[model samples]
Target: MADGNGSEKEAVVVSNKQVVIKNYVSGFPKESDMEIITGSIKLKVESGSKAILVKNLYLSCDPYMRLLMRPQGWEEYSLLKSSQGLFKIEHTDVPLSYYTGILGMPGMTAYAGFYEVCSPKKGEYVFVSAASGAVGQLVGQFAKLFGCYVVGSAGSKEKVDLLKNKFGFDEAFNYKEEPDMNEALKRYFPQGIDIYFENVGGKMLDAVILNMRIHGRIAVCGMISQYNLDQPEGVHNLMSIVYKRVRMEGFAVFDYYPQYGKFLDLVLPNIREGKITYVEDIAEGLENGPAALIGLFSGRNVGKQVVVVARD
Candidate 1:
């Protein structure tokens, strides 16, 4: 291609692979529900345009993404408006993938929901559901760092061990083996829980509500258990909240992006000094993105699930 001066113009084009939804999902999502397709794009930004073309090195496979597979919800990344709501990676000392989990949205979620929403106090008894996950793991660690006694719940024994041994939770349990959640909470928090980081809602929420102390705070981060269901499960313990004077609040990480600088100020130092530990389950290629995403629903991934599209 030649420009106005007849000099050769260089335009680099590349194949863009995307994992797109095949159709709206009804129940538990499967790998077949999403398809990876290849398209091409010019690696150049238009003159006087605010758009910036970025190479996505890592992609986060969060549980909330399942909701977007439905017809009403929209996909997150788009070729256009790429610069909007994007944060620049300022720190290079740590692994870049950390931005997808501990240093990114999930990290902000744990920060806002735990410190801001929960109003955590030193020596408080804290309980975290889905504790081995990207956000829950950090929430447990943050609670421990805040001088609170932390207990976390996961689906499998491996994750249960990871919670106590890796993330430094005071105690951890496998929720799958516990037939009665109320009894589980009673056994873990005999004195009653001061703060509850709600992740997997449903019976867990109901159980936590029954075990909350007076003036207890519940930070509702997500309800992964009810995402793919045709009808969401009902929480039968609403009356207990009134009697216990529990303060339950639901929060969105989107509302807290403006505080990203403050979050990095606290987290980056801890990460650099080894005060914080993080684990990631990496899917090596974009083609594996579907499996990585589906793994979140079934507890297949050991830690934060991430897809690495490129290395450089």
Candidate 2:
């Protein structure tokens, strides 16, 4: 326990194993790009600093984490930003790892992107790409809760089934099997998409453009498909946005952190009563972090991927 002076009765040090990016990645990240190195840190908060010392129990494995691994301006800020959202682990029935998924950043993202950006209405046709992912799964669920007809697209048949059965999506299809995305969207949403939760971008965005209704809203959350590409694929459909008066907006979860308290109020009860559910692919130990993160690009993870650093 910390005292008034921000010091523990006795100093304690522990070996801290970290998975760090060795260099800026050129294309798709490999397990070799990150190395697990052992270091040591004092388990005490600094006397004057505002920093809170936390025993990191779980780390989130998100597709956006790839952006931080690349050559970016001030990578430490990305790390610190996530640290800012940490929740203390006390007595709880839920898994501690839930903080890294549905109950935390990803949940906030889905909430903000759908409600704030897309402004969905009841009976609206909502389509979520990569719908089995951390954010997308929640987005599809939120749309259902809001009384919208929701369809999800996933890579594998198993994931599509999870989206339909577990997450309660109105319709779900394996995107890998659907070579023509436009035809697939037409099959699922014959009336045309009112709100398109864009995740897997690229050619999907182009196909979605042709299927969007007049005055449609597109919440650009992520583009996992183009993240590893040397040159991102171009979407030749800007004319549709003008012709249909479509509104497309990109957003970051950090901007909506202030509404977290309200978000919890709305979601917690649903989660507790079994009205909402989430999926996670947890990898044990810090040493496995590299592999867990690298697996995301290959669609190896079924849902939200998490890496456990310590059980307690």
Q: What TM-score would every model get versus the actual structure?
A: 0.94, 0.91
lDDT of 1 by residue, 1-312 (tens): 123222214666667777888888889999998887776666666666788777778889999998778532112223566567776787988999999999999999999999999999999999999999999999999999999999999999999999989999999999999999999999999999999999999989999999999999999999999998899999999999999999999999989988989999999999988999998999998889889999999989988999998877
Best by lDDT: 1
What lDDT, from 0 to 1, does candidate 1 have?
A: 0.89
Clash pairs for candidate 1:
none
- lDDT value, residue 39 of candidate 1: 67
- Residue 243 local lDDT, model 1: 98
After superposition on all CA atoms, what RMSD does each candidate show versus the true structure? Answer: 2.9, 4.2
Candidate 2 structure quality by residue, lDDT tens digits, 1-312: 223343455667666667777788879999898877776656655555567655677888889888889532211111232346565544267777888898889999999999999998999999999999999999999999999999999999999999999999999999889878889889999999999999988999999999999999999999999999999999998899998899999999999999988888888888888999999999888888889888999899999999887787
